[model samples]
Target: MKRLLFIIALFVVPAFALEIQNLRVVPKNIDAGNVTRIMFKLSGPAKLSINVKGLNGASVTSLISNVLYPAGQFSIPWKTPKKIESGYYIPVITAVDQISGESVTKQIETRTAKMISLPFTTSDLPGGNKEISYSIDKAALVSIRVGINNGPMYKIISNWELTQPGAYSVKWDGWDGDHVIKVDQLANYLIDIKYIPVEIDALYVTNPKNISKKTIVPASEILRQINAFVPKYSVAVSNKKIASNSKNNESINLDINVDDNTLEELGDIPYEYVLYIDGKRYGEIENTTSPYNWEISTKNLSKGSHVFTLMICTSIEQINTRSFKVTL
Candidate 1:
């Protein structure tokens, strides 16, 4: 009877759920060209997945996906991507017990986090009389645009301008392209910024005529390639007419010509052109052969003057804009 009781007691031990503890991200404030480590403890054997996400809740990268980890302390090293945007990031970890169908999810504490501070401005003026200021944490391409809410972007303060880490300020004269912005207009501003990285593989693969194949590429040549990455394009319309006839809804032919004429000239980098009308996105053409054409429909537009803006952009952000008045 004593042996039988001991066997029954052993079989009655309840199973515990999956658990994670002591989660940490070392070197919370990662610098450019640095690596971070994620460390954690598990109570029992489980499959785990770890991912880093930005402040906007977008997954930036995944360290591991559903990999089995033994019941012990584990550490994961993650090297920051060369072209990662400057901002804050959070590490999310998940663990699952296969047999019990139990799972646990947790994020690192805010105190122990990764962050890259960005530029900011304190003044807000509708008349555009105030000076916009920002601090660049690293060398980057920056641009600024201002416009009324849900209307045409009237002024472009900068266009893919190379800037170094420091404090910078620029004042706006409150001028829309044609005239001074009115006091009643509610204008909005956009600061497009992105860091540039030296891409050797891209240069080799693209085989741009400007950059010759060599075992070692000089810094000046690399800088030239970086500058070429900024999109230089021109916009043209076949007829520049909103409607061929008022009775029917007709589309107009729009063409965008890349100044370089060939993708190889730009290292075959991914890019796109976005068309905006009255501050709203109209159409977009992503990485494709040159001579991008889009059909702009004028059926919904009111019979008056409208702003037609063509913006060139890359994975990072907008590089340049070409805006003009189109009267229907």
Candidate 2:
């Protein structure tokens, strides 16, 4: 009986083996507006099948069934849907060996794209001056149109034009035709512009007098607005606490927050940081005006109790600063 069983097993032995050599998504890094392709490679003579599913286990659109090929090497392509938001997606590839009745499966990961928007701002020009200046990057395609809140009358100061790709700049000059319009007398005019890669709309305008007395526009607010206009494809922005100056016996520790919003709206800005002693400008942090954060060291500062001041400007149109003091 043993000899007969051995003979039967030898005669029924499988003729081929199947294996999965590799499985990968063509573009590992995918953005918000692009599509990702998935490819698979196999070895041996086997029937293949593939299925792509999202994070929720719901199958991605267009991926239906496994494809059948005559063995050797084969590849399959799958496209990611555009409606999918920014996140991770997984796809499954399964293959079955016809001769050995064996099967294998693989899971692939894909990422979704990121979407970025623009920032808006409203502020007085300076010295309680009625004249208001609207400024944006020279690279960003920007156009300024002024109209009353409820009136049909409108004026186009800068028509929508692309002088460059990333940064753009335009000045209102606070005038209408030959007549120099007083800032307070002008109707609330709405301004609209498109900063490259992002669109900004419905930004309201108000006379400087309309603002609440207690409400003050912080320089950082403009920075945040500028960052919102930057294209999402370029860089990321975040706020964090950093050490200003740490050296020798005299050191000042302060919180510094930085982001990209300022660069997107204001164009290239010079770095500036203000130093304060006991809530006063020690030497006035100069050149700390860009969108990035400032963390300078005061190790060379004289020893004993001392306060430090730090200031940051948001836009080139207006110089805004914030101050913080610390004792050492």
* Cα lDDT listed for each candidate: 0.59, 0.43
Best by lDDT: 1
Off-target runs (Cα >4 Å) in candidate 2 are 1-16, 62-64, 109-328
lDDT at position 239, candidate 1: 35
Off-target runs (Cα >4 Å) in candidate 1 are: 1-117, 122-128, 135-166, 175-184, 187-249, 261-264
Cα lDDT tens digits for candidate 1, 240-260: 433444335455566666565
- Give the alpha carbon lDDT tens digit for every residue of 242-295 in model 2: 343465424434545445664554455444444444433455345443344444
Q: How displaced is residue 5 in candidate 1, in Å?
A: 72
User: Deviation in angstroms for 32 in model 1?
Assistant: 29
Q: Could you tell me which 10 consecutive residues in candidate 2 have the lowest summed lDDT?
A: 197-206
Best by TM-score: 1
Tell me each candidate's RMSD, in Å, in order: 13.8, 17.5
Error of 2 at 3 (Å): 24
Write down the worst ten-residue block by lDDT for model 1: 198-207
